[model samples]
Target: MISKRPVHVHEAVPHGDEPPGCTSRVSVEVGGRVWLLDREADMEALWERMGEDDLGADERLPYWAEVWPASVLLGRHILRNAEVLCGRMCLDLGCGLGLTGIIASHVGARVVAFDYEWPAVRFARHNAALNNVPQPLWTLMDWREPAVRAHGFDFVWGGDVLYEKRFFDPLIRLFRHVLAPGGKIWIGEPVRTVSRPVWELVRREGFTAELLTVEKVALCGQNATVNLWEVTIS
Candidate 1:
């Protein structure tokens, strides 16, 4: 019964062009409960802005501004399996809009969520308040040089983080460094050609993975299936 609906405008103020930092609020229903989230109002505008900007190697566009289907699928899975995560240490990587972390907190998991950009972390904090969940430790973090402790987490998860080929090896190293003994990892992803070699790569690194579930998701007039995989050290 997950649904996405537009926010009603109580006071409409007309403007020619949307300004920077302009945002929209959305309601996402998961596990029979509605959660509120905020995102950038104009995706194309942000992309255009990024095009004109001077950027470093690590900095990228505002891909975190939109709620992707993988996040929804992971959120749904967390809400449904709340009991298993209760009191467990969980980390949400690239926690865009903080939906999965908030849902995990609601179900009583100690959550630590991080994003590459500060805006995404800010939005996650705000969304946690909106959803009435205990705020997780939301931090601005670059996964390439993470400032986290070794073997610190029990369950580390991410949604749609496998978009870039360069990140594959770094991500696997991060997983190995941070995951505690007997800990697990879950990744939710859409059907993508670039992601086809992921399992083979992980298996080569001595990790085992299995498809846990597939969820059909609709976003912005498109329908697709999101796959969730449970991975662990072999």
Candidate 2:
């Protein structure tokens, strides 16, 4: 079941040195526009806390709470093509810190940002507020849910969501279900072995697929290449 309730981080007596909701401010520049994002200050500490709190496998790791390089590239791409977003209804699938949806909202698109993790949804909301962008509808939802399929999105954006081969089929099914007529899906993925088969499946599904751009991005102090792909049903 999908929950629309927003989670708040309350300060309780800490089991360790750092309490929950510890965050740092990060400024990102995309196409001459700047967005300020708030992220967990220490991911390792957060992970430990998650373990203490007995979060499940998906929630135990705070991977969704950090800003990823692919997200940065996707934000840049959205800002570069801002005009296309005006008056569009967009979806940010598995939005981590909500950078892509925030950029889409900044560019005048009506956006719905979704993540399966409640903490991630909270952080995404906080990031939107931090940047002074209009808050998109933040929902804690799994991609395979019937609620997710109910929305007709004109453009669906995701970053670094193609890393696991196990999720490819579900992701593709969700994309096909949510996309409106004449809609497009934009994905920014780091070059990985799993990405090839996913792309091939997308092609076999009769979508017109193309590699829109490839650029080097700095991730965790290391340079990596990110490829942006555009897909539409033919």
RMSD of each: 8.1, 6.2
TM-score of 1: 0.87
lDDT of 1 by residue, 20-48 (tens): 36378877767788788876654456667
- Tell me, by lDDT, which candidate is best: 1
Please report the candidate that would top TM-score against the real structure.
Answer: 1
Q: Candidate 1 regions off by >4 Å?
A: 1-22
lDDT of each: 0.76, 0.73
In candidate 2, position 226 carries an lDDT of 87
Q: Which digits, one per residue and each the tens of the lDDT, describe model 2 over residues 3-77?
A: 111122222111222213736766766667677767665456666665445654444456676677788899888
Residue 4 deviation, candidate 1, in Å? 22
lDDT of 1: 0.76
- Residue 174 Cα positional deviation in candidate 1, in Å, after optimal superposition: 0.6
Candidate 2: segments with Cα more than 4 A from true spot: 1-20, 52-60, 149-151
